[model samples]
Target: MSDNPMPSSFDGNPEFKEETAGQKLRRRLREEPLIPLGCAATSYALYRAYRSMKAKDSVELNRMFRARIYAQAFTLLAVVAGGMYYKNERQQRKEFERALEARKQQEKRDAWLRELEIRDKEDRDWRERHAAIEAAAKEAAKGGPRPAPAAAASAMASDQSRTAEAPVEVSEEKKKGGVLDAVKSLLSGGK
Candidate 1:
């Protein structure tokens, strides 16, 4: 006879086997049925699904955080650029206002200068006309109607002298030489 043991028919047919040690323990645990083993298995599977969802949520949160940071940076850049542009515009406006004020002041000054110039010209013309009238009056005062040719010539010569108003005769003592006159005389004598 062979020394080998016979192979059982149950080992060849896996579906016809009795409960194992582990299956017996599980059945004993499920006897009270506080929470069935199947329910516990499903709860554990749902917990694993929740953990996967939490991980995906964390990835999305990180992407949102990066986008927020980029948005903040761009907002800061826009604010600074707008502030600079406003400052430049304000300065330009101030310069334009200053130029306008200067132009107004210049126009006022020019108007004043033109007025003074016109007044001065009018004064000069009036003085010239007055002097002409005075000379004609003096000529009419000096003569009778039509003197002799020789007398008329002499009278005309006298009239010329009278018409040219004589320099005011200051006293000789008042007309004493100044320091400049003395120096000029001394220099001329030496020469």
Candidate 2:
């Protein structure tokens, strides 16, 4: 085995070496600090102090103290304002997320309802087709005996009669007599 590493084919590829100026700038910016608030606050405080001391009088000391106090107050206010803004932004983000979730749920519900409606319509159509086929079968059966339209009507009537005459078995417990018999026995004298 050789101690030297094998050269990859991509080493000679021109596409790997291609990079635009904008890409390089973006890479540099990404590597830089994101927020420079520390430097900005220090610079602002120093500038305010410099302006406050510029006045040369006994009142200048008072003004400098007041300016310093004002600077402190402003710094505190800015901190508080920034905190409140961030809190409000977070709340707004939560509300937007909730609204998006609710919209998704509503869309899912609507899709389900549409699917159910389509299924119901298909079921109704199937039942209607089945009934028509049954009617046609009956007509054809009757026409086998007599080749007239009246025979089909007679066959339908016969089918209705046969269905009506079919005996329906009722259980002894459900013969509509259990409760009534008990009531009757109670009304009678210990029968």
Candidate 3:
């Protein structure tokens, strides 16, 4: 009885894996075939040599012994060749992986730099707006004649004292020192 049953068709069974004789042979051959071939040849030659000795045939025994040595040498050479190929493949794969990682890191760094530049530009714009507001305030102070600080405070207090249905926020314009004083301050500045 078979422990594993291979489905006849994949249409009926998704897990079914169908392989033709040639496909199986090619796959097996690609999976390091030389060493196994050497081993088989060596074992057959040794068996033949044993049988020749049993039959009391010295010439056949000598020939089989030589064949066994040649087979072993072939297997050794195959193993060495396979090892070299494996090492070369591994080194190339490692180099490819390293290059891929470096490219990903470079992309990440470029994104970070772009984000930093955007933030810096935003900060620069904000500072320029603030400086312009300060310049306007200074110009207003230099204008003809300005009311005293005490009068200004009194007028602000009177405005706050006005009756209203809801509690209104006071002096919203100068809340964060963003814009000029009075009506001009109310006309500008969001942040």
Please tell me which model should have the higher lDDT, number 2 or number 3: 3
Instruction: Give per-residue lDDT, candidate 1, residue 16.
Output: 31
TM-score of each: 0.31, 0.33, 0.33
Better of 1 and 3 by TM-score: 3
List pairs with backbone clashes in candidate 3. none
- Looking at candidate 2, the ten consecutive residues that score lowest on lDDT are 2-11
lDDT digits (tens) for residues 1-191 of candidate 3:
63222222323533223456897568647767998899999999999999999999999999999999999999999989887877865465455546546656767765765454444444444575567556657877889355566875675455434322223233532363322332333434523
Alpha carbon lDDT at 43, candidate 1:
52
Give a tens-digit lDDT track for model 1, residues 1-191.
Answer: 52222234323544332456897567645443433433454455455556656778766555555554555555566556555656854465455546556656767765765454444444444565568556656776886344356864575566456434433222421254333334445646945
lDDT per residue for candidate 2 within 62-125, as digits (tens), equals: 6555655656666566666655656854465455546556656767765765454444444444
Give the range where candidate 1 is weakest over 10 consecutive residues by summed lDDT. Answer: 2-11
Model 3 whole-model lDDT (C-alpha atoms):
0.63
lDDT of 1: 0.50
lDDT of 2: 0.52
List per-candidate RMSD values in Å: 45.5, 27.4, 20.9
lDDT of 2 at 130: 63
